[model samples]
Target: MEKLDHIDLAILKTLQENGRISNADLADRIGLSASSCSRRLDILEKSGVISGYHARVSHKALDYKMIVIVHISLSGQFAKTLAEFEAAVKRVPNVLVCYLMSGEYDYILRIACKDLEDYERIHRDWLSALPHVVKINSSFALREIIDRPNLAASLGS
Candidate 1:
């Protein structure tokens, strides 16, 4: 991948603020011609620096009121066991994020549900179906203290 410079950073920042912004407006904001700005953005996209654009949706507005953070420990650490666990987790629609981490737990997953009863159903059916899972610890988030969608782009320089 190509190294990004100040101009690239500016383009990234502008895009993050308004992904739907027209190329003409973006060029004006970045002090470049429309064609040059378009070319730079295309290069960024082709190089994998710009993955894709998305609209940030409000979870609360969508009636998703609960967030569950689950720390999971697998019984075995083989390749097959890991793959099976990941594949099962990927099939669950409510699971928002999953991370493999260094701790007592092998995997941590973020799950969304309507309430405690909804979570109980998910735990009984989905979480329990994964392979080699021995322990599952859960914590409920009372509130989102800080959340930002354009985190990576904001860090660019």
Candidate 2:
């Protein structure tokens, strides 16, 4: 991919703020003609700079009141073991985000539930069933201070 210039950066910033913005408005914002802006967007998409867009939904409104962060340490870090664990996690509905990290724990998962009982079911039925799980620790969120994915903006678009 080519290095992004100021216009590309501006385009990314605008799209992140409002993904539904029309091409004409985007051109207006970035001081370009509609066709030129459309071409840039096409190139951005083709080059994989712009992956996709999604709407942010309120979990509270959906009655998903509990947030749990699960830290997992595996018995081993073999490729097969990690892949199996991740694939199982994908099948579990409550699991929202999972990250493989370096440090004391092998993996971290962010989960949502309706309440403590719901969490218990996930702990017992879903998470606990995984093989080669050496240690499992869970922390329930008391309050959500800041919750945004904090999408990349400083990467020069």
Best by lDDT: 2
Best by TM-score: 1
- The estimated TM-scores of all candidates read 0.93, 0.92
Per-residue lDDT tens digits of candidate 1, residues 51-136?
Answer: 99998877778788999999999988898999989888899898989998887899999988899998999999989888899999
- Number of clashes recorded per candidate: 0, 0
Q: What is the lDDT of residue 34 in candidate 2?
A: 100
- List where candidate 1 sits over 4 angstroms from the true fold: none
RMSD to true structure for each model, in Å: 1.5, 1.9
For all candidates in order, the CA lDDT equals 0.89, 0.90
